[model samples]
Target: MPVPVVSVAQMRQWEQASWSAGRTEAAVIARVGACLAAWLRRHVPHNDRILILAGKGHNGDDARAALPHLQGRAVDLVEVRDPETALPDLERALARGPDWILDGLFGIGLNRPLAEPWCRLIERINQARSRIVSVDVPSGLDADTGRPWGATLRATCTLTLAAPKQGLLHPAAHTFTGRLEVIPDIGLVPCPIQSELCWTLPEDFLDWPPPRPVAAHKGTFGHLAIVAGSTGYHGAAVLAARAAQRARPGLITLITPASVYAVVASQLQAVMVHPWSAAHPLPGRYTALLFGPGLAAADLPAEIPATLARLWQEANVPIVVDASALDHVPRGPIPRDALRVLTPHPGEAARLLGTTTNEVQSNRVAAVRALSGQFGGAWIVLKGYQTLIGRQHGPIFVNPSGNPDLAQGGSGDVLAGYLAGLCAQPPLQGDPERLIRYAVWQHGAAADALSRRHPAWVVEDLVRTLGRVAPHRVASTARPATPTTPP
Candidate 1:
């Protein structure tokens, strides 16, 4: 199982438990520091200069603990005993201008904002020209709320101890946390004591979507029906088809408006293309369905949602509702066993929930949970930074993949298609929540890898990258992975 979220109170309880088990604080700090030092050695050059900003808290102790392992590097320390008196020491260290600055001023124990000289000290650190790496939680960030309490300093990277802090995974915390990497085996186990979120890990790729039988036929993986497209938005359907194709679905049937069908058909080779017809809105049997990519409300008939809902009344398959289709999700009671997955960005989520976009983004975890309850999607994927995927009656997952690369035009369409394609694959459809998590992770991971080659990528680049992360894990084959530590 993926690691669950942990709050400061839970962390304290864990500390007490570990203490009862004869695990001392000094020993745990040493282990955490050693693990971080190992990771730094792998990521940082040996010759680079390092400067440590030590504080009076445990965060500072953790940073100072690593000093022994970083022997060969040019290192210096600025101990902050009294910020008012330590300004001279801090200035002298900052003037040296080391290549990397380790901010170890505070951790999850902090509940109030930084006061007086502490705030000025952090501000001065932020002004320095070196890359900053925070030891755990940033100096002034609220570990539980995932917000800057006050006077927060931004970091180039955050080398966290044990499991990652839940606040660090917040969408709003990225600016302060930078690239995050967890230092493991320090004895902090974030069990299911109290948390609604779990972090998706790379190991999830194993044993999922199972493996190809080698003698498999086209019908083995099941059929995917993608209903999308309009006149000017024909490319949306093509992108969805391309993504689904890369996802390795056995057969793809793309249904588009007749006026745009020719354009979409010309852009694909394997996908079977069809035109929208009121007489038979949805035609054959399908294992899964993807709907609403680039569908223009002006183009679709007023009664299209009702007609499609009536046609799919008895179907017991998973459906990915995305883009404009979110507005037309079939009304009335859904089929007993049918799985409905809704993918909505903040704006679309706001429209569906009858709330403002700010309200949804402010507390994405709450918004996602509310979405599943109000909208009734078996899986609700709230798409944004640190995308949150919520199951109707299960715990939500926080996906830690992708970057700014996914803020493009057709990326949502690709993700929607990928979700449907994964659902179509047999054996893997048994676990609905895990399947959605896998799909969302792979989608962002594709963006993370492709973004390296180009500063910005078209949705097509993401579609092609899906082939690399596709779920086809066999007994002996391991899927390729990009380390969480940024290169």
Candidate 2:
């Protein structure tokens, strides 16, 4: 199961409760130190030179406690505010050029800006060539907001204690909190039972692509219908269809505007393409529908609203809405029985909410929840840094796998089509929420994998890399594990 992300205040509350329950502060600090030291010994080589920057508070106490276990190495420990010889000690340590620097300075509770000497020290740390391991939250970073308090230490890895801080999951903090590791069981217990946010890890997808029968044919997998593309944006439809193909849907039929039909048809040999028309009824046999992506509002037929209404009301299949299709959502409340998923970036979400992008980005959780409620139990994927997936009456799923490489155009279209394809698969049918989550995971996982080879990757690269990922298969009769927390 994924772990909960708590704010600094919540963490403090938990710490106080633990202390009242007989775990003393000193004892907690000792355990954290021991665990951190053990983790370091296991991951870091014993021969590497180490420098420990200790502050005056419990963060420093934790680092001090670890000294006993980190013996036999050239380790230098400097207390930030020590009056006698702190500066000389720091200078000498810097001169030695330690292989690793363990930053135990101000932690999550810090809210104020850094002072002169501390600021200088942080600047030096940032300039250093040594790898940095930050204990708990990195110094000079707001653990609640993921914003830097001034000059913050950029860590090679952050050893977060107990639960992950809510701020660390913020997209802006990814560079500073490189490769987050949550240290479990450091005297903090009885974790908050419910939280608005939870982070997704790779381990959560260990049982993906649930097994299929050997005797099954293409028809057994299921088919999907994609309504996307316009005159100039034919590439959008091609990307979506190609990504859907990579996801292994049984069959894909694309309904596109006549202006772009020939180009899209020529590019895609496997997918069946049909020119969209209001004169004819939409094909109704597919198990899932993916709407939007490259469609132009000006070019939509006069009867499109009625056409969409009919498909949504009578088709009784999962519909994934994105891009231009989102512009046409009925202004009134959606039907309670509708099975729909809306994949919108902040701008599109803001348009649906009649608000600004700033408002949507500022309070993404509330925006997604409001969308779900207003749509009468619809599922929503608010795509951005830490892409969020939420359904009516369900907690948000925070995706932690994507990077800046996915910030380009047409990425959301690929995500929408990929999700639609997953929904069309037999194993994912009737579970719109899980289907969306798994698709989001796969989308980011592929981007993450491709980023290691190239500095920048286009949407097509993501489509091609999807096939290289190894799918975990289970017994045909097996079911996906129910997440402990709300999924």
The local distance difference test score of each candidate is 0.77, 0.78
Q: For residues 1-487, could you state the per-residue lDDT of candidate 2 as single tens digits?
A: 5667888888888888887788788777777777767666665788888889998888888777677767676788888765244677787888998998889988887999877777777887888899998999888889999989877999988888877898997767877998676665576667754587876655566665667788888888788889888877888998999888888889999988888889999999989998888764464678788888888647665565566656655566777888988876654455455568889899989989999999998788899988887776678899987789997576788875567789898888788888888877776675666667778978887887788678777888999886455523211111113211111
In model 2, what lDDT does residue 30 have?
Answer: 75
| Model 1, C-alpha of 301: deviation from truth (Å) | 5.0
Which candidate wins on TM-score? 1
Stretches > 4 Å off in candidate 1? 42-48, 71-75, 147-149, 164-174, 179-181, 189-192, 279-283, 301-304, 311-313, 467-487
Tens-digit per-residue lDDT, 293-366, candidate 1: 86874767555566455544556777788888777765445677677788999999899878999999888887
For model 1, what is the alpha-carbon lDDT of residue 412?
A: 89
Cα error of candidate 2 at position 7, Å = 2.6
